[model samples]
Target: MLMRTGVALAGFYFVAQGDWTRLLACFLAARAAVTRLTRPDEEKPHRLAEEVGREP
Candidate 1:
């Protein structure tokens, strides 16, 4: 969860900075989103809402 948050935050920061070197924003965003979407409900170790907290 912490990893996900950090990735998303950093991605947004890079996007706002308009730095192509950090175009990793696109990659991070896609990865986080794909993981969230593909994770099985029962496979999750914790409650969905609790683990992910809030979304941007």
Candidate 2:
């Protein structure tokens, strides 16, 4: 959560400096980090099973 907030703040800084490309990249990275953090832990077992070629 802290990392996501930092990334968002960096994005804002880029925006203030008119650095559109870096801002967009930072925003995308922050979104991906948040999405990863919020995902249900229940999915992990299924993912691990798939990785090991086993049924979940």
Candidate 3:
């Protein structure tokens, strides 16, 4: 959440200041932040199945 908010603030700041280079870097960081935000929790199904298998 922080990363996303920081990126958005930086984007507005950079655009307002007409700083193209930093804005491009912000865009790159945005890609990573969005990817992280969208990724699903990958461990839950495996853990659930293992626990079920172990119960009598």
**Candidate that scores best on TM-score:** 2
Q: What is the C-alpha lDDT profile of model 1 across 1-56, one tens digit per residue?
A: 99999987786677758766566666677789999889997766566567689532
Two-way lDDT contest, 1 vs 3, winner: 1
Which regions in candidate 2 have their CA more than 4 angstroms from the true location? 1-17, 45-51
Q: What local lDDT score does residue 44 receive in model 3, on the 0 to 100 scale?
A: 33
lDDT of each: 0.73, 0.76, 0.72
- The alpha-carbon RMSD values of the candidates against the true structure, listed in the order shown, are 12.1, 4.8, 8.3
Candidate 1 regions exceeding 4 Å error are 1-19, 44-56
| Distance from true location, Cα of 35 in model 1, Å | 0.2
What is the overall TM-score of model 1 with all chains considered together? 0.39
Question: What clash count does candidate 1 reach?
Answer: 0
Pairs of residues at least 3 apart in sequence or in different chains that clash in candidate 3: none
Residue 15 displacement (Å), model 2: 9.6
Give candidate 3's error at residue 6 in angstroms: 17
Which candidate ranks first by lDDT, i.e. highest?
Answer: 2
Query: What would the TM-score be for candidate 2 when compared with the true structure?
Result: 0.55
